[model samples]
Target: MFRVFKTCHLFKQNKIFTRRMAAVNLKSLSEDKIYEFLNSFDTVLTDCDGVLWMDMTPIENSPEVMNKFHDHGRQTFYITNNSTKTREEFLAKCSKLNFHATKNNILCTSYLAACYLQDLGFKKKVYVVGSEGVSKELEQVGIDHCGVGPDTIKPGVPYKTFERDPDVGAVIVGFDEHFSYPKLLKAASYLSDENVHFVGTNTDERFPMDGNIVVPGTGSLVRCVETCAERKAVIVGKPDTYISKAIIKRFNINPKRTLMIGDRCNTDILLGTRCGFQTLLVLSGVTSLTEVNTWKQSNSQDELDLLPDYYVDKLGDLLPYLEKFKPTNASATMLKFFSKSLRVSMAHMLANKENYERFATQRSNNSLLAVTYSLSYIRIDSKLCNQSHVTSANPSIIVPIRPDITEYEFLFTGNHTMAASNLKSLSEEELKRFVNSFDVVLSDCDGVLWVENEPIPGSPEVVRRLKLIGKKFFYVTNNNTKTRAEFLEKCEKLQYQAKLEEMMCTSYLVAAYLKEKKFNKKVYIVGKEAIGKELNAVGIEYIGLGPDPLVGDSLGMIENFNPDPDVGAVVVGFDDQISYPKIAKAATYVQNPDVHFIGTNCDNQRPSPNSNIFPGSGCMLRVIEAAANRKAVLLGKPEPYISQTIISKYGLNPERTLMIGDKGDTDILLGKRCGFKTLLVLSGVTSLKDLEKWKRSEDKEERDLVPDYYTDKLSDLLPMLSNS
Candidate 1:
């Protein structure tokens, strides 16, 4: 039960409460981590105003982020609750700010108000207690509206003598510069007939203020009408059903394939929860981490609805990942590491200061450089500070060199810093040593082995060689859309040998996760029959598997909806049969407060055989997230849970394990976090340019995305394996 505190002191007391649930902070993660999160959504529904701008000034890099989504073939829409602006006005602002948008991609409160009235088939006039934006939008839909001009309250005016229009079948409330007592009286008089509808553009309690001064929101006036007429108004904006239905129907959006990015949890995150879109909260706007923590402790379901699936410090931080780059000339590079120490003999070093200074000056002038470490102490002239070589008694002292020295570079390569990449190709001797170090191999299926459904060159030979040599390998995939049996069948078709136990997929991991947790309750499934089958195999019953075909008189299902008490969890994956009823049921079941939420994987796009894009499981998972207002335990790549299971089940040693994958964010990031050596194969997704960006980044989080090693393709390892 949700408790409304009458006193401010009780509300303050609520802040200190503790809860286990928390949003995953995407800001601190590597570039690969952010990429995995972004790839899980097909459509992006973003809130404007605070998220993209502070009133007028654009938030840094927001425009580029939206454009990047478009470049990646993800759909985007700007949804706002500011009813004062018409569609055209919003478009003008978007254009000025360089936000990549179109008329079809913008969804505002005024436009939603017009859509709601049209859906209602209300031919009669609407008495609007708002601005010209609402009236203009209503006009576009061929619906007549009035009450736009000033209706200011006069001191001597007789309130009882106010006239009403009989043709006014509805009262629409929005932001109004001319709102007065007379307009309220007129609107209430018309709404007295319970048949006359009352529509509110938004229910925001207050507008974001500049300082101490707070402006009243449209919700204030909507309350006045409701208080007078004793009837609840239909809200058309965020956290409401009207806009969600409109956007879904207009765009034919798949709920399972959409994302909602916003700053405010109450409106933006709440809307996402209602629509089943994955929500990303940014701290660049209205919400703070402290407010989210307070919500985490709340028992109220409404408070829970405000939680986002993931959050970033700001949207602009994604710029470094998306920025374009061109690789430098690779011919000039040289391999550097040799036996953990330089081969230069310290006995040959000159102890004389003048001799050392002259030698250092000549070497510094030349671009050619070599780094040597010695325990012996030697002093050089202070004037020769630009010298390439510096001898110190301190073994830890590192000699600094020119920035343009690309022939050989010694980057701080470790678990704490970004993984260093070899600028040059690997030698035959080096490849053999690298391949011999790992005892177990964990490989990603889609990109590493095949692109679009066909096996890459030399990939099959490499896998066969590993198997022939008795190397233990696991085909780990975030492809929860298909079952392990299906995956094994695909492997057979591709001529790649695999055992059922050797395949680790998100679906199987999800089932294993539930079984390990000892959860015996039935599950509400928002996915295909394959997921249901997996659950059944683990003795977990499930409902809402296939499409719940829409019926003409289906309002009864919603009105009389009753969730099963035995249903203790909601698991979401790719569901071709997804429908309104399935979403309703899953959302309802999850609302029980005790029902756990689980997602197979957060993969948004699948690589098609023809190179076309298809929605992945993340879409469906998002839909349940929006409706249930809860986060899911993701059992897939980049999420530590799946890796933990694989580690425990196979008894694999992280120190001697190599994780090979095409995508760096999911496959490589997963390997890095699991304490395994990661090798990035440029057979798909991440490019050499992408790797260079992470390597050059100052942000430690972005630097963490760099892989321990990289190769042109997985096939490059075949020659060394064959010789072995």
Candidate 2:
């Protein structure tokens, strides 16, 4: 059946042939081989869009080939990632295109979404970010839903005034032309509750379109919601195992005996390979023969999995093969003979397995060799097969390692080869040169200057000495729980020299931002009294300062919600009394596209006594961000706002300024981003171990957290600069 030609001249001479390349040209096989390939499978699953028809036009002879499969008693199923149509609509299209299909045979994503929820025993309403097809499918399953059509943002109507439906407990993302900010807001708001379920129909980034025109797919919308909600969705379409699970549960088909025919390798071929089905790639759709060949050459397992077992120029090309293998009374006897011959050949090969393995190992060490048969394919590449026991003649292939170096030491040495230098390791002369390199110093408060009410030993003295040496010092803290004056008072209490103008608290930064914008509207506060006081200093009216706990159920709260129409900005900071009502109100106000949303800081946690972890303002800000489905303008350390303000106001050269702190992510990263010299002290949040971790991190952001220099504590610098 597999006609092995002495000279491979029938195909293109320029193309290199390899036994590992599984995408065999179906036309290259003999007539008997084609018949055996066709008879190997009893069930067929085919993609609809590009294989059967492209939009409305059917490919030539494709319908006849598919219909012939049904005629041959093969169970046929139409699977698609397109969520824009219902099963009934798909069936109608199939009928018009001359492809015989019933509702049971169609498996569109919209219908699958409904089935997914139904299987979960979901009784609550669904918040749909899709089209009428999805809503219609939900209707068929007796599921309540909303948000199908255009829900445009109205002029002058604040999003805070919009009421939330109490019954909506799930959000489903699919393709929708009317994907607006309002829909994203509602969907994210519902998904903010951890109890709410989230589902995505598919993750195809875009649709296949002609010419240079590119249309975004449902994946774009799904990603947007996922980003705002800060959660992942359960995908129910191709490439995911959910569709196969559904098919297995409903039909109980044998994966080994099933044939998957598709045009796309990423979704179709990948799904088939994952499900243990024989894959046939049609070149008429999204994939091409050149792309298949490229995948065959790749060493990556992911790329290798994309290669199909067989490929043809088009689905219509299979018509000739099917016609030649038409059923007859002699077909059964021929199939029996073919099966008997395969068993006998396999048994014979097994008898000489030891000799074959020895030869394979010898050949693998010399060169890459593969022997593919019609029934089974085996590749003998030493690089891929892990035959470590086989000796090679080439001595260069063996890599020697130093016995003295531990694995951890080797890895750490490589990872930290270009990491930050230790400031304490510098000589007294070098330390003096480093001290004189910068004229201005920006210091963080909590971790660097002091921890809570107690100052780190000798830190105050170091600050005083730096100032005495003519260095311009400023206190920059992300703590928004206190006003600038209160911070200055604390600095004085801790024996640190500071002035009113030298303090740069986040509360002051928020007030300054609004004042510079010349904003005249009232501010909605989701923080403590310090923010309100700062706004008062700038002559800005503010509300929502104290406790505003939830009263009754969420439904009643929404019904009686009365948003302040005059409010124009929502400011988020640290709140000791953060409540559901405050978060809900802030989210609602920020939803209005015109309203400014500001976050004081993004610190996840703060240092506390007795080893207690205290949640910071970042936690509260994320809650509001998730509910509003929008990012807030950050004004804390590492965000550039503080550095930009200081540079603009004081006319300090960034290259000549030094930033000293005890946190790498905030303090040191801020200095790095602003082009300031960074010095990390281990007297507070960050330690020497944290620095080592950052130096070994593969993430650029984490690596950037490494400071220009590091020390055990702020006091360590005092001994280095004693003479100076």
Candidate 3:
């Protein structure tokens, strides 16, 4: 028998449980409905500990259910609030329990603690009031830390006698077996200076109570420090959304299709709800049905966030439906909060609370209908489009709705929906008109045309369609790793027609810059064969092509490195075989002050198809700049050099051109600077969240990175092109 709490009489007798939440019970569903529900999600983000097992013991059939979920082509991630265990430790635990796991699949607060400090560019030592887990994570990021070992209680000594480390910049609190008055005093003393960062692993008040034993969790220690320090700490665990932000940033998660499963309401369910992920509550842990009923009767907004969209007796309950499921592309009707045209649809559907209550109360099919935030909107599934006009509502409050899209799936970073009173998204007519206005299309090759070595789905067809429509096409790339000939071959392999004159590469532009200046000297190159080939093609002499051999010193003296007299410039690009000798040689050449320094591009990371990021040319260029104490003239996108080359050589008009790429900082900013329209596609590196960062930033350079328009993928535009 399922647990039932009749807290119905605790509140106003008129209110009911269904009014607060209509969570669907999977056990009540038919086999077909169960299959459909199971197949709806592509990813499952489950809370560790209670949901999977209790301490070290595995929950019955939970591991089997997880393996089954993975078998059905669904991605599974273990999200946990426990900060006492490092990711490696957690992975070991998962392995011991026979659970399928990987390092990338886990997001624990201990790891988040280290990531937080790293993001802040912290170089100082961390004073930890936790375990080896937090210290291990900090060590992994090359962050020095202290205060990990047991601090034995000294009953007679005063707290003021303890000396604090001057280098400590942050105090971290987690589960500690040796937490005492001395340690607490040390943490509080460090935090007395308000400038010091205070990070708490989580705020979980208590651990799951073993009968007759109530063990205090990490929060108890954190609260002790908070009380003594009289300062609030930034929580790095779930329900705070810091971990969620980091996870989404690392893996481009589509919230709409992602399912967050957990056993607790406050942390697990609330996080999923706050992040706009579909939530499922299991009844095997901390929260009981009685607490849910109490919250429902209270009618608290915060309480409402804790409610789950669906609930089950246990996670293993869905195991039977795994093999029988058939995934489909269909989606539920979505209400677009930011689109102004939605007002018309709002009038037709149920409006106001009274109307919604009547419609909701009439339904008794046991199927849950989760009516989330935004009351002034009606339900309709539609695609988002760009609009030129700004409405009275804050433009940042945009919430796009498509049958297949969700708030999480939107992938842009921003606060929760700020009720759009008068905002607008473009209509179908506006989109068609927008597409027809562009006469020439200039696209970034790495992210826009192809990802890694493979072409993005439907991209080649889009290029062919644009060519068929008489739109002049050009492939622009900041990847100096590949020569123009290599890029041309890649285009041809992907069925994209190309010409030598129509392509603009950083290496080619560097060659052009050298040729135009009539440099009659050799270059100290810190790049690959691609740059060498381009330079050789333009009749420019160069050295430092292959690995620069290290010079050995027999005595206790430094090896005297000298630059060739003929070297008049230092050129850097993406070199997989870069070495200290090469950097020393390049730096030695550029330090002459007469020698010019030119970098191919400044892209930080190269995007890969399998979602891995490799450090790009910018890293090498920065190394040379730091060593030489001078900046290089960057010649790629967003820099005027490449744009100058294309305009001067091809006579391309900026007014009729459209720049497309997956990177906003380069492709979008370049378009804005060159007076051309820009479109950001999600098929590559740049996520909707990354674009939103630049949109919200107060810096002009950041604001300039915003794209004129965006699409989920490049293929999304194919239908519009066909219609046009």
Question: Which candidate ranks first by TM-score, i.e. highest?
Answer: 2
Worst window of 10 by summed lDDT in candidate 3: 1-10
Q: What is the C-alpha RMSD of each candidate to the true structure, in Å?
A: 25.6, 14.3, 25.8
How many pairs of residues collide in each model? 11, 0, 3
Which window of ten consecutive residues has the lowest lDDT sum in model 1? 1-10
| Candidate scoring better on TM-score of 2 and 3 | 2
lDDT value, candidate 3, whole model: 0.71
Off by over 4 Å in 3: 1-19, 332-724
C-alpha RMSD in Å of predicted model 1 compared with the true structure: 25.6
Ranking by TM-score: 2, 1, 3
Clashes of 3: 3
Q: Which stretch of 10 consecutive residues in model 2 shows the poorest summed lDDT?
A: 7-16
Candidate 3 TM-score versus the reference: 0.46
lDDT of 1 at 540: 88
Score each candidate by Cα lDDT: 0.70, 0.76, 0.71
lDDT, candidate 3, 1-724, per-residue tens:
1111111111122233222445667788888666656756778999977788988888888898898888877889999888888999999999999899999998898999999999999999999999889999999999999998666444466434566678999999987755544565578678877889999998765555334223445665676567556578999987777877887789888776678998888888887766667788888887777877777666565676577877888887877777566666535412221121111223232233443334444543222233222222223222221222211132332322224433212212233221111102567787778788789888998777787678888899999898888888889899887788988888888878888777788888888898888898998888878888999998899988875433342111113444478989889987655544565566667767788899998876667433222456775675566545578989997787887777777788898889888887788889988999888887777776766666655446667777778876777778778977
Candidate 2 positional error at 644, Å:
15
Every model's TM-score: 0.48, 0.52, 0.46
Cα displacement (angstroms), candidate 2, residue 552, comes to 44
